[model samples]
Target: MSTLSYETELDKLLKGSNISHDLPVSQLVERALERKEGILTSTGALRATTGKYTGRSPQDKYIVEETSIKEKINWGSVNQPISKEVFENLYKKVLAYLETKDEVFVSKNFAGADIGYRLPIRVVNEYAWHNLFARQLFIRPNAEELLTHEAEFTVISAPGFKADPNLDGTKSETFIIVSFEKRTVLIGGTEYAGEIKKSIFSIMNYILPERNVLSMHCSANVGDEGDVALFFGLSGTGKTTLSADPSRHLIGDDEHGWSHTGVFNIEGGCYAKCINLTEEKEPEIFNAIRFGSVLENVMLDENRTPDYNDTTLTENTRAAYPIELIPNCVIPSVAGHPNTIIFLTADAFGVLPPISKLTKEQAMYHFLSGYTSKLAGTERGVTSPEATFSTCFGAPFLPLPAYRYAEMLGEKINQHDVQVFLVNTGWSGGQYGVGKRMNLTYTRAMVQAALLGELHSVETVVDSIFGLHIPTRCPGVPDEVLQPKETWEDKEAYDNKAKELASKFQENFMKFDKVSDIIRNAGPKF
Candidate 1:
């Protein structure tokens, strides 16, 4: 039997339209520049602006409620359900729109680094830069793999195609709908490149857990001795920054799956926050922006050098670069079971301790709570640090119940005897306005101590409200700063803030009624 060709599969979607299949990175970059899709910055990075939609439009995203996976889905405000009829109509429309186009670019890649569980994906993009974006973001297939490649899932992205809300049964012109039964993702109306990356993540989140693998939205790195550490956090909590440690080998910056054998990265690249990026602070990420990297929504000066401090377009400015660009990244992006799991939180309220040890039950509680502040401009219309609770650190991408993931994490922690720590990279001394952000050096030192097991014998003091075992004697951090209450001039005010935050935690936990009582009881008590 003859092997299926990439062009043949792409032709089925093209409907006789011109197709550009698996173009080399150089050609893709040349085509993107010729099309005026983006400009080459002085640093040799391609800076592209996602018109109208600088960030993800979660409200416009949907999943087809087909019979096969309908009941399995945790249908809610996040996983909004659309009818099969609606999906069919939109899918047909998207195909027709593509057929009318003069040309389209296609790239074939895999989503997981572990070959056994990897998902073969073919991304069809109407824009050249988007093809480059997909190439950099997803794991590229080698010549041998490409020859036999059959896309298990396909993403048809046409940012120029807008939807009619009334006619299409959509919320707005922008739509990102996933059809598990069809094994296809249809993205239209928004040009945000992250939509492509996250669509695959959502699919993995749904499929991996059923296979007994725990898929996570976190960052992972391994020490010199091969001890692995996982960092779980939402935007602005330093998951990317802290995980890119020079001394350690970076397994991946985001999206990983932990199976029985070990942990593997889901992405081939890093989508790092570029706002206020500097070579002095993050040399690896800053330097990784040269050639082949795609800078999204970042401002460039007359000299075409990126203005990292500029947020005029959006604070959610990002750079997408392949893992190899980072000097110390681990190839194949897989590592052994993690010895330490860190839950990073940017507590705008500033009453939480800088770092604390977590009991298994507490780990489950915080995992479900997924508390963090939503930094400005990460999403459309978001302008300030708003208290947000995303179950499992990435609720938007999750299709199953929050408890399902928390249950998997609990089992993994026990099975591996993994030490869990909750590190607050947010505010201290006072709330957001009055308090300063936690010092990065102190946070790094605390994390280092945890990774090296230096905190095992350290003295701890319990926070009465939150019940976290705050370490009193971290090596490099000041004694006073370890305790949130002591760092504040007004202790009474700190007490009030702690209770308020504790009450918020309880309120959030109320939504997860199906969680175990042990986990519920482990939460903060006012």
Candidate 2:
């Protein structure tokens, strides 16, 4: 195994005062490891695991391939045999960090078919949690489900890194790995075995995509011809709710990977907002989790399992189950090139054009803008209605430097000739600040029109604000509903709200003012 240096940049940050609290790493790693072993020895683990978890290095271990992309990204092939050398390298990096944190405990269990180790609750600074752990270890609940039946699913490996403080006041960095089969998650060389799985999963979602996938914030899925469309925005921006249509076979909801052929889901399951979710509201997804669903971090009953009806855990309560659990799940983890790319934004300010066909630059512009209303309680810190701009509707986990993926999108759009559309999945007659949300039924109908290619037939008029062609009216939906009205319950209040939202959009567009004429003309769109 390569000798890993104990000092990582993250370690330095952990020791800084900016951190509110510190959990002992050395102590936690020990406990977490023990828990893992206990779980592995249990009947559940035995039934689930098929092959040996450890083995000698595979013959193809030493060969390294090259990519033109600037970063030295690792591309683990689906066909290549996993190597022990790689595992050792992971172990070494994890061990070095654990030792530095002084919170890790080592174990060698020879009694089982394979040897194992563990870690307990350990403190990891937020920076390390967000950048390193989130980036290196975060696994999508859905992706995990997709790999569940596969041999790679057994270990549930989690690699986390932390830093110690330096002279410049930054932390030294180190990495740690905790395997779930062993029931542990390590931080700063320490192990934590408590209710850390959910926390670990949450942090992981925050980072892992930056590695190799072409991740977008938009809702992406494979269409009939294998084309993928990505819908993006904050929670309640219609990512799960809108994409739940039965007409198109559902790929995974939310996050997706842009593979060479096309896009594939990174998750085996969907993490949807359950606030207003119901059989009538989201019938397709609501029925998907009846038997196989695993509700995470939820309020449990006497048996220590989740209470599906319990709202005590907060509205963010989530459920994870394999996509196959859904009545119709398209698998093989691949989707064809996107035929149409629809970026969904819930425009609270009803003044902006309802729908617009985007040119290439406009697509990137809106993606970077990442327009979505900050619904009151979806996130922890966001309390009010704030406009968020995430590149490609997914700013958080983008792996390649932003533009690289944009370039890839450009390449794909050019090659496959995919069409892009921006739809407001929010209110129309009023602004988010003052008006009511757009009716779900109407939004769904609009989406149906766009997907079926019927919206293109509407009379085209150059929108005054953005200059993009706005369909005068969708066939099934009313025209008056397309634009915000001034004569609602409070006309003056509606006008004020509209102005505020329009200004916000313009302000958000200022940074990208330098984009080329075609692209620029394509945006600053209302």
Candidate 3:
């Protein structure tokens, strides 16, 4: 069948009473409980388990090779390409499977917070809980907007539909296929709801850049003076924790777009990590988990209260809640262009400065580098912390060339005179097992100094290896703590470890073929 044939048929399947259209959170949660799709925790948040798959199946993800995006996509292991026939076959299977269900859920929403740039989206899920995940994660349209809504892109997720790899042309029974030409994302076999959220982000990563908007994988907030700040980091890097400042109004916890006018959140809600969660550590997130929020894979004790520390299911436990649930969240989730940018890294090696100012070139360099560390015991055969570098801070979601996003960021930084910094939230004094982690109080103090412009004119000393400008003094932090080597018991060991990490940076940068000499020179020096 032709693409139009399937598109025309989808409209008919979605309009009947068998489709629960635009259900509220209460109705969705009720349906989910009645259907036994999930259970309600003591806090009133619904908890659902993603049966075989607890995380994203990146290897099985694909983008259809169509004439429109044929020459544009960075096509590789990250953005794999499949044929139109394969996508059509799998998409048909999913829709037909949904037809067999007692009922399906649908939601009409927007993606970008900026009205001008917002992309109208429709999500159709075989599970009620998944639809709730969509409604909470995406920008929910008002009643007036929904009456006139027409989705430019559609996501059809039927986790019950399992593909036949041989006949279905899939890497596995689980597959996430995005057909830009068809304006649809077809997910099957995997029960993971995060796939639904990320698939849309991957699509936005493609669509927004074409409009000259730089889509970013970062958390944002605005100070009292309306000075905006951006925090870029991967999971476990404290991006969410740092951006949840009691003093600053949070713009969004993850995924934002920078257009000519200013910064806007791409998501209507925040999906926070729930492992090791505590009210004392993240009070806002703890309080936000009431009534309408959705929790994934979090264990519950006999009293039906969530055990945030339990990881029997997976370490990637998450909770999705509306942005407004956060008391200090910006109403429209919009802000002026960022005045400050912080690249957060948990450098376990304990060599980088606690906090340091960055030059434009260095910012671009580090932005592209996107460095972090994976601690030992987190994975098998890992006896020590390992270096991790994801380009543009979000390599998995970037469908376009890495340099495309990097160039856009550089242009924006130059145009707005943005100040960027690298803050290490990892171990200090020595590598992971040897030293204590950087104090959260001190980390917050250093970040506050940067946001308040306290580090702007303070006396600075340049690091010999990485060329980062370290602030000599910071409020609420001892002077020695600001210097990594000064706190270390053995100074020579610090130099050796610093050099070791510098080599890893050089090795990772060799993959980029388009970086310029100036930005290239901004990395660590031997």
Best by lDDT: 1
Q: Write the per-residue lDDT of candidate 3 for residues 1-526, one digit (tens) a residue.
A: 8767988778878876689999999999999999999999999999999876877777888999999899999999889999999998887778778887899999998999999899999999999999999999999998899999999999999988889988999988989999998899999998888788888999999989999999999999998899999999866677778888898999999899999999999999988888889999788888899888999989999999999999888777889999989878997889899989999898989999999999999999899999988543222234456788978888878999989999999999999999999999999989988998899889999999999999999999999999999999999999999999998999999999999999999999998767889989999998
Which ranges of candidate 2 are over 4 A from the true structure? Answer: 1-213, 222-228, 297-312, 376-378, 486-499
Top model number, TM-score: 1
Q: What TM-score would every model get versus the actual structure?
A: 0.97, 0.61, 0.96
Root-mean-square deviation (CA) per prediction: 2.8, 12.7, 2.1
lDDT of 1 by residue, 13-114 (tens): 755647889998888889899989998999888999987798889999899998899899999888999998887788778877887877789989999999
User: Candidate 1, overall lDDT?
Assistant: 0.91
For model 2, what is the alpha-carbon lDDT of residue 507?
81
Note the residue pairs that clash in candidate 3: none
CA lDDT, every prediction?
0.91, 0.47, 0.90
User: Over all chains combined, what TM-score does candidate 2 have?
Assistant: 0.61
Tens-digit per-residue lDDT, 1-526, candidate 2: 2222323332443354443332222222233334332111111110011011111111111111212321322223211222334334444454444445433222111100001111112323222211211111123223333333222211122234433333111122322223322222333322121112223332223233343335544455555655466665656677777777777677766656564556665544565555555677678866664433333334444654334466554445554444565555565445666778887777656655556677777776666667776664444444466676655565433323446566666777777777778777766666655566777787777777777778766676765555556676786667766654432566676656656665666787676645566654555444
- After superposing candidate 1 on the true structure, give the runs of residues whose Cα lies further than 4 Å from its correct spot: 1-11, 15-17
1 versus 3: better TM-score goes to = 1
Which one wins by TM-score: 1 or 2?
1
lDDT of 3: 0.90
